[model samples]
Target: MDGQLMAFTGVAAGMVAMPGADFAVVVRNALDTRKAGVATAFGVAGGLLVHTALAVAGLAAVLVAVPVVFETVQLLGGAYLLYLGAGALIAVARHRSAATAPSAGARGEVPGPRPTVRLGTAQYLRQGFFTNALNPKAPVLFLSLLPQFVPAGQPALPRTLLLATIVVGMAAVWFPAVALLVDRLGVWLRRPRVSRALEATTGVLLTALGGVLLAELVLT
Candidate 1:
């Protein structure tokens, strides 16, 4: 069992390292505020808990077996991403407009650094949670991955739970590590031009990913 767990750990590590929409969300938020990034990172971990529960309770199989259920998850996931992406792009436009618009600076008053949205902790956490929870891929991965790791002739529940916990633990560590690294670079990332450019790019990437999900659902 130790050897099996070791192998599973390696596989989990690889999966955690793979950049996905979760990584994008973390980076995007982290670039804005370190605390937001950290909160988002753990919120994703919390999402893994949701998947773990579904997988453990064997609802994931139901999700997979029912085409309607799977499609609904896909639809929701795609729509959520699209919503976030559109929001980011809209923020960029508004910020740019604000920068150029006539303001008190036009008079003798000195202008302050342009105001930007600073999401509260709970809101950031929700952003992170929904970003991961809505994605069908995590549930699918949990459902498939855990069973493979459980050794033959062993009680499945305990082993499955342990393995799921491992995946969640890795996510807890890995995503936050990413957020911290990005935070360390906050000095430069917070700069207006660089920040806005990255924000716009992340937005486009998210929107494209969402589109791909919807397209795949259609094609499938």
Candidate 2:
């Protein structure tokens, strides 16, 4: 149990820091609107809760039953990570361009469809719920990787819930800090060259993570 907890914590920590669809969406929403940042974060986290539950229930079993499918998931996850990393890099590059800079708008003015029109307290709640729910990786991650931590013949539900809770809670804590940090470092982060570099680095990390996951699947 101790080992499981520690491992889960490490994974959770990594996930919280890593940029994903959830991270991008939440950060965009938070930065774009008033107090919507909190709402967005919560929305993403809420989505995680649903994913966690489904993963713990029977999804993990399905993955374990068909190892090939599991491998496919790992490959797909890696690809997804790469895609996100590339997107961030592209955003950074585009923002750097003189043509795009004016259109980038001040601080929060990237023109597009806003995540929400309501902008009420409820909007925040809904944002948290939907962002997490819609994220496919959240469930796949829990189902694919978490079972490795379970002990043989042990009832998995309790452990799964615990792991999921840790992940979600950690995300709740870490992502807000991220929002603040990103917001604080807005100028530096938004700097086209710097943003591009960071995005590239993150992209590399994602690809590496994918490689690692694939390797693990192969070894098993």
Candidate 3:
């Protein structure tokens, strides 16, 4: 691999792998339904494709020109993280309430909405796609960060495509493994206590990530 390519790949992979809204959403879906997780993973990958194409096509340059654009994206990304975190916290609260419900405990009925066949794979996929796609930071990151790694004279299109492929490939490897692991874990992952803790942790992480992004934006 070209040195630049290697560096770029490392950066892209690191960025994608960082636990954020995207990672949280996918893992949540996987734990919720293994099949749906697979679809969600693919959908997130599709959003990456769009970002990669935008970067390679030079559309990102438009974003680079206005400092405000990057700042705006950062703010939006921060807000998104906050929103996701709040949702996770809500799930945790619901889980706790359900677990303690007197009648439910006595009757052995879970207090939450049971997952049904209605929560199909397509819905998860669509959720994943929209969640990642709607987040402004994703495309902005590709636009702002990716070009920095491209060599001065190289055909950016090929380089950009290569970078995107490698990053997405890494995600393909990591998330399905997560899905399979969750599948194998079976009922353990579905336990109310387990779900509540997971959601709570994810919520905290998202909030922290958002705070960091917001600070970075303010400083920049």
Candidate 4:
């Protein structure tokens, strides 16, 4: 393995490990079910592949140079994040209210489990894909950051694909691990209070991140 490739791998790993939208999406879905979590990870991998393809084809660089395009994407991304966060927060509120409100119960009648709106695999996949794909940061990062690691005197296209693929490979491994790890904690997470807390926190994190992203784009 080339020394430069090793360094790139390290940096790419760090980037993938960062707690961004992808991380949020994985954790959010993982809380629901392991299948949801794994599907989300796969979707995130798909999103990364899209970015790599764009970077390899020089579309990433082109988008970077075109500020309007990047800005538009960022706005949409921010809006989407805000929507996700808002939805989660709303769910939390509804859950809390439902918990607190007293309903007439028959004497000695057992209560059934509250109905949950389980999102299908396709929905989870799309959620995960959009969470990562909308950011526009990938193209920018690939354009600026990937080149620094590409070895000189090598075919740039192939080298770019190789490095980009490494990032994708890392993402593929890391996110599913994250999903599974969170799934392991399902025992405690199954508790309503704990679940609601997790939901609320993630909701705020996503909302704030989206607001900040949008604010930055608008203010700058």
Candidate 5:
């Protein structure tokens, strides 16, 4: 059991370290505000809890068994990603336009307004939650990975929960560390040009991931 626990921890750590949609979202939010980033991290952890519960209850197996159900979830998740990506791009465009637009002065001179980006706590949290939860892959991953560590004839639920807790705990630790690290660089990232670039890059990556999911559904 100890060996299995160690193995699971190592694997989970690797997964947490890998940059994925969750990482992208967290970094993006963190670049904007440390609080937003931290909130997003917690939201991602919340999503993991949901996935863990589904796996423990064996509901994830049903998703795998029913192609239609799985495909539907994939489509919804893909659409959500697309929406977020497109919204980000649109926001950037709007910001740019606003920045360039002429502003009236007392002497009839015009000046550009400073660009700004703000996301409420609930919004960022929701974004993080959905980004992680909607992936469909997360639940599947838990379903696949957790079983390997469970001893034969042992109660699966307790073991699964224990393993899932480890995974979530790792994410909680890793993501906030990332947020803090990024926060250290916040001064430079807050610059208009750098901020816009980061936003665009994150948006593109998210959109691309969404496209891949949708393509997989179509092809498979």
Candidate 6:
């Protein structure tokens, strides 16, 4: 059991450290606010729980067996990424417009209100959850990876749950740490030019990722 657990932890840690859509979303949210970053992290963990449930319930096998279902999930996930990317780009445009426009106050000298960042807690959570949940690769990950660690005589479901729990815990730790680090840099990153650049970069990356996923679906 100890050996199995150690292996599981190593694998989970590696996965958590890998830069992917989840990491991108967390970094983007962290630039907005620490709370947004944390919320996104927890939401991603929640999505993992859903994946774990599906894997344990044997639904992951069904997905793998059905090509259409798998492709549909891929398409949906890709579309969501495109949606997020477009929204980010739009935000960049709005911020640029606001920066260039002077406010007309009573004295004609008051500063304009800062653009309200729309990343509320629920939005953060939903973005994270959908980003993680919609990816067909997540289910495939668990389905392929968990069985390798199951002890020969042990029940698969319980063992899979235990391993999945380890992954969830690892994500909970790693993402919050990322949020804190990014938050520390918020002072510089929040500058209008820097923020716009970051936003644009994130938007481009997400859109490109979405395109790649959709291309794979089409080619396969």
> Which candidate number maximizes lDDT?
1
Best by TM-score: 4
Question: Candidates sorted by lDDT, descending order?
Answer: 1, 4, 6, 5, 3, 2
lDDT of 1 by residue, 58-109 (tens): 9999999999999999999999999989988998887677666677448655
Question: What Cα-based lDDT does every candidate model obtain?
Answer: 0.87, 0.62, 0.72, 0.86, 0.84, 0.85
What does the lDDT read for residue 162 in candidate 5? Answer: 93
- Cα lDDT for residue 64, candidate 6: 91
The residue ranges of model 2 lying beyond 4 angstroms of the native Cα positions read 59-118, 183-220
Q: What is the TM-score of each candidate against the true structure?
A: 0.90, 0.57, 0.76, 0.93, 0.89, 0.89
Instruction: Give the range where candidate 1 is weakest over 10 consecutive residues by summed lDDT.
Output: 107-116
After superposition of all CA atoms, the RMSD between model 1 and the true structure is: 2.4
Residues 147-185 of candidate 6 have per-residue lDDT tens digits of: 999989999888888888888888888888888888898
Winner of 1 and 2 under TM-score: 1
Candidate 5, residue 133: Cα displacement in angstroms equals 0.7
Output the TM-score of candidate 5.
0.89
lDDT of 3 by residue, 1-220 (tens): 7788788777766777776677777777776778877787877777677777777787667766778876776687677677767877777776677668798789987565323233677777776665566566666677777667778998877777777778778777766676677667858876766767776887888778778788888787
lDDT at residue 158 of model 2 (Cα atoms): 86
- Cα deviation of 192, candidate 4, in Å: 0.7
After TM-score superposition, the amount by which residue 199's alpha carbon in candidate 2 deviates from its true location, in angstroms, is 14
Q: Is candidate 1 or candidate 5 better by TM-score?
A: 1
Clashing pairs in 6: none
Stronger candidate by lDDT (4 vs 5)? 4
Tens-digit lDDT string for candidate 4 (38-139): 999989999998898888888887788888998998999899999999998998888777665556242443333332568999999999898889877788
Clashing pairs in 5: none
Q: Measured by TM-score, how close is model 2 to the native structure?
A: 0.57
Candidate 1 segments exceeding 4 Å error: 100-114
